[model samples]
Target: MKTIHLGVFEVAGPQVGGTLSWPHPRSRSAQFHDLDHWVHIAQVLDRAGFDFLFFADGYGYPSVAGDLPETAARGGINFPSLDPAVLIPALARETERLGFVVTSSTGLDHPVQTARRFASLDHFTRGRVGWNIVTGASQNTVAELFGHTTMQAHDARYDQADEYLDLALRLWQTSWDDDAVRADAAAGVYADRSGLHRVEFAGEHFRSSGYFTVDPSPQRVPVLFQAGTSGRGREYAARNAECVFVQGTTVAHTAANVADIRAQAAQQGRDPASVRIMVGLTVTVRPTHDEAARLRAEFEEMQTDETVATLYAGNTGIDLLALDPERSLEQLLDRDDRGPVGQMGQSNIDRFLPKDGSAAPTVRQILDDLKGKGTRGFQVWGDPVEVADELEHLMDAVDLDGFLIEPIFDPADLEDVAELLVPELRRRGRMPQEPVAASTLRERLIGADGYFRRPEPAAASAHREP
Candidate 1:
């Protein structure tokens, strides 16, 4: 019965999940590098009352067991991406109250660089920025790109990620005090030297002994987001993230995940209710039910089984191409001693692999129900009213905070939602009547009662180990 929160999942590539919408006549995904395409989408969402736009980035492309496919380029799958961070200032210039969440990995990027970039983004976006902290994905492929002689163990990466976040926190939360700036032209004093403290963190994977380069921006730290369903990932998100994302296969499963994360947050010395939970959602809306169904049919035609295979193999590092169709997902996970999946990892494996006494889903299931019935999360296809109805029901069903809209087409699917779905949601009192303006992205997006208040973390010096 609370007002529903919302965000759109984005990437700087033509592909998202297994959907081939970029090839569609109406899709603008092919022009991904163009600011015009992004600006248009950002403006549309800003007008509609969307809270934030999240870019899911990664350093690696799909390569199963170190096998590079020549077809990757031809397929135009999840490849050939521009770094999404570069577009934030432009989008911020175009819209107000639309926060930006950029994904950066601890394994692939140094903590200092991550801290500096996000601080700059916070300043550029006027406090409308978030960081989706991920360990890394596509281990073998990314390792090759970074010239890692051997891949770090999955849990070990999480261990290192723990320290990485602390280091970044020192820069964001402790390096510069809120009143560090003293802009008094008469005295020629711009900053107080006493307020700037040097960060002296020496973790296993990183070390920093200098003062944080940037001054504190609004919110001090960008809103923290985490999107991993693995056990270690759940603990990591619970302990650190203000916003958590889940890709649910069923209504019951996602609800359980929500409860689990909240419970873990409580155990981790944080408020259970303050960990905002968002599920991935794929919406297909039209003026009529028949039109919606027809549109959905077309989407299914575009989202081929091979595409799902690519998505699965890339995220889980399990090569569906080389495996027997009948093999269980657990069997594949068992074979990989290094734990192929970590943060931003293995949604399908967690969904399809049977933990109950039931038979495990075969690798072939990724085509059937895994990637079937549309893209990830709770899916709906109908008129505006019908779509809105299902969304409300699901929100209550799971005690959800928001949904990450995964557009099947770049701007077209989002256009349909903005044009058709938002008005109905507003009419039903599930959305604000006016655009949310002059609010910090933290307060407007993830920081509130229904959406969970963004907690102010203590200064990083307090976290130093004795």
Candidate 2:
């Protein structure tokens, strides 16, 4: 049996995206800004032999036509979004082996700024850092928040990202050399001047013409992760991402996604095996089936209809409740009565639009679908053995690399996973008996020991040239 990788899908707010259960008995909503709370969760996951904690973030909330919904605010939807990148170092300090993958946008941060920030994080965590490369989520809302008059089209942003990532890769892989640092005390030499290279690159969207200020750190470039599944997104992931995150609604959906990405990666001149794919899963495991079912019932009860609708509106920037129940999603977007539209998440909105002459899903039908799963679709409910069996089957069936264990209840549910689910996996030879503490995150994730080595000087670089 192959050991599966695990990561907790987390956000530093009242709730994760698109779920409305802040009032659940096990919710950590009261401690969204509490560092000790995060520290405790990090320690728990580290002890469980999980690989990383993945944070999904954006600077937008539920608003329509410049109007904020009272339900989203009162129900504590994806509002009060905190910066997860600022919270990683504290969590890293409290754990030994666990890595962290934080979401950051190419549209929001300049390449030089992003490069330096991840470099600092890499040094702080001793190589346990990864970047979830996002072009934009809730782009219109984010663009408005950042004072942009208009948002770029979906594919256009990905084009910008290609340029942004190219610059960052050059800075991380080219600016320093193997023997750049030499702390020779007697000679009073700190760094070998000849070993440090100053880089200059000009691209369509980004440019940098200077030496990277930070010295070489372990895994100089953070593990690259991407979470888009559109045509453009798949291409971006194939060409750039080492890990791809997908929230597949079914086994077949996930399997096709995995196959497409691997094939695209091959076409991009990459090793198909290098692009690892992960799916979102929310598990409710217990000692028995009846008991797990009972707990799952309570979780379902917490998702009231209005709150659920409010979460959908906030995330997609369409106030479905205020619109006609019979109107299709595409029709609603084109309605003159619709409010100020932000371009935060095009892929999310695109999923609902009609293709060809096919009829689009109506507002009422979309609401019903939200009631069905929304963000919690790929979940499993059962005791330890059953959950582990499903996991094994999914990995084999879909060719998945791992699962993002979205907590049914943030830190509280994770405890159950650590205690019940992981031990069973270990017993079945589906997990390592002992985890090595000293391996860098890249080594732990892919078992590639020397994969973090630097590239050749920029003069003969494989990356895009200036």
- Predicted structure with the largest lDDT when compared to the true one: 2
lDDT of 2 by residue, 15-133 (tens): 76567666777777558889998999999999999999999998877775566678778877777778999999999999999999999999988899999999999999999999999
- Once fitted onto the true fold, the runs of candidate 2 whose alpha carbons sit more than 4 angstroms away are 330-343, 350-361, 436-438, 451-466
| Model 1 TM-score on a 0 to 1 scale | 0.93
Candidate 2 local accuracy as lDDT? 0.80
Q: What residue runs in model 1 are displaced by over 4 Å at the alpha carbon?
A: 333-344, 372-375, 448-466
TM-score of 2: 0.92
The ten-residue window of minimal lDDT in model 1 covers: 449-458
Candidate 1 C-alpha error for residue 20, in Å: 1.5
260-314 in candidate 1: lDDT tens per residue? 8999999877888777888889898999999999878887776666666776677
Which residue pairs collide in model 2, if any? Answer: 65-340, 137-344, 138-344, 138-345, 139-343, 139-344, 139-345, 140-342, 140-343, 140-344
TM-scores of the models, in the order given: 0.93, 0.92
